[model samples]
Target: MGMNEHDQTKYIFAQSIKDLMAKQPLDKITVTDIVKHSGMTRQTFYRYFQDKYDLVNWYFEKLADKSFRQIGNSSTLKEGLVKKFTFLLNDQIFFMQAFQSKDYNNVENYDYQCILEFYKQIIHNKIGDIPEDIMFLLKMYCHGSITMTVEWAIRGMKESPEMIADLLIDALPPKLEDLLSDLR
Candidate 1:
């Protein structure tokens, strides 16, 4: 499908940010730099994004959506969780630096929402009635897992994504365990 002008501009801007992120801290990056890198005028940049923070938020949101879609059809919760985290940690060094920067503070919350929505869909599909307590537990697990993942990536994803996924699967609640096992 052809991308609209807005999407094209947004894509260029996002690529600019990703390119700059490798060379400098997020705080050090400016809209001017983005414009220059993207080969778009400053006015064009402003037309698409209010500021760099807005661009950062949009980038993370897009990544989260992509990750969720990639793992949305897993047969087991363990597999789903692993796929999700694996996607997040795949760009380990970039994410580690990006998530730690002040510019990306909202990225964590955005990621959390994505994780919640992804699991909510899965739970709703598997069992129409997901108890409130179970829902809460699942949310907590998602947040905790992502938090640990952020820390791990920052610390250098020293271990493999599979190892992290295994640890997370081992920590699942009994209800989740049963659900995931049943799927397997």
Candidate 2:
């Protein structure tokens, strides 16, 4: 259950970036700052990540994986959304800054892709085959949700996590909602 050496190292680097992000923007933070904060060498950092942006992606992916694992099969989509929103709220500063990154290849895309894949897997398992229209709708919904999430973060996340989750669930397309009714 404990972290392996590789994971441990990555965690350290992630923490360093998170701490730095609290005081500065992602674009302003450098690899040297991360290594210095993490007390690891540049070689150590490059061994695991190409840059801080890569670390941001890894951190978000880790959070997405952890959120799903915690939800498992017993929980609903609302529960999943609550957990994910909590993670974002808990690390508000880090996420607020990370969401501000102008880089196209950042957490926003990663979040959108992760959410889309999560829905696809669930829909595929529940209905066997997904129609083209449903798939398009699913992608559109995921993109909207992620965009809303980013705006929520950037805007200081004034709303409660549960409230945001409820709104997102309410916004789901009727057909998709019916398909994922049990989950919602």
Candidate 3:
């Protein structure tokens, strides 16, 4: 499906917020700054997003969707996770800004939830049947993955995405080894 004008405005707001965040914290940024940066009016900004937080949250949702789409094609689900981190590395500026935001716990916040849910979907696709009985365990995997990845991001991502991918693979619980281990 194509993006409508409202979605386009959201994109505009997202980019504008990212740009502003590069020079300031999230709390300091207001709707006016986002609209001014995007060259849109405040009313138009409000029509699409209630606040800067909404814009940032929505932005992460879109990014998660895009990243998940690519992850689906990876050779192994683990490899796809590395690819997702690499995607964030490619957008380091924004992620770093998000990482630095005040009142934000990158691993325990809205953006973290988006990434977690994306990973959950990937796990469901791989197993083909995510029974309700194991839902908590599935969420645990998602939370652990997002937490580890965001921790790396917050610490400047010293390890390359490939290395982080390998670490994540090594860190998987023994029970999941059969499910996530590479078949080839």
lDDT of each: 0.75, 0.87, 0.72
Which digits, one per residue and each the tens of the lDDT, describe model 3 over residues 1-184? 8889888878888888888888887778888788888999988887877677778777776876778456656778677777678878987777776766656533247755765565556556667776664566556766787678767877888899889888878777765656556522
Q: Give the per-residue lDDT of model 1 (tens digit) for 58-104.
A: 87777766674666556665676666667767766557757776544
As for candidate 1, its clashing pairs are: none
The per-residue C-alpha lDDT of model 3 at residue 11 equals 88
**Best candidate per TM-score, number?**
2
**Arrange candidates by TM-score, highest first: which order?**
2, 1, 3
Q: Write the per-residue lDDT of candidate 2 for residues 47-80, one digit (tens) a residue.
A: 9998899999998878767774465453577887
Better of 1 and 3 by TM-score: 1
Clashing pairs in 3: none
Tell me the lDDT of candidate 2. Answer: 0.87
- For model 2, the superposed segments whose C-alpha errors exceed 4 Å read none
> What's every prediction's RMSD, in angstroms?
2.7, 1.6, 3.3
Number of backbone-clashing residue pairs for each candidate, in the order shown: 0, 0, 0
The C-alpha TM-scores of every prediction are 0.81, 0.93, 0.79
Please tell me which model should have the higher lDDT, number 2 or number 3.
Answer: 2
Of the candidates shown, which would achieve the greatest lDDT relative to the real structure?
A: 2
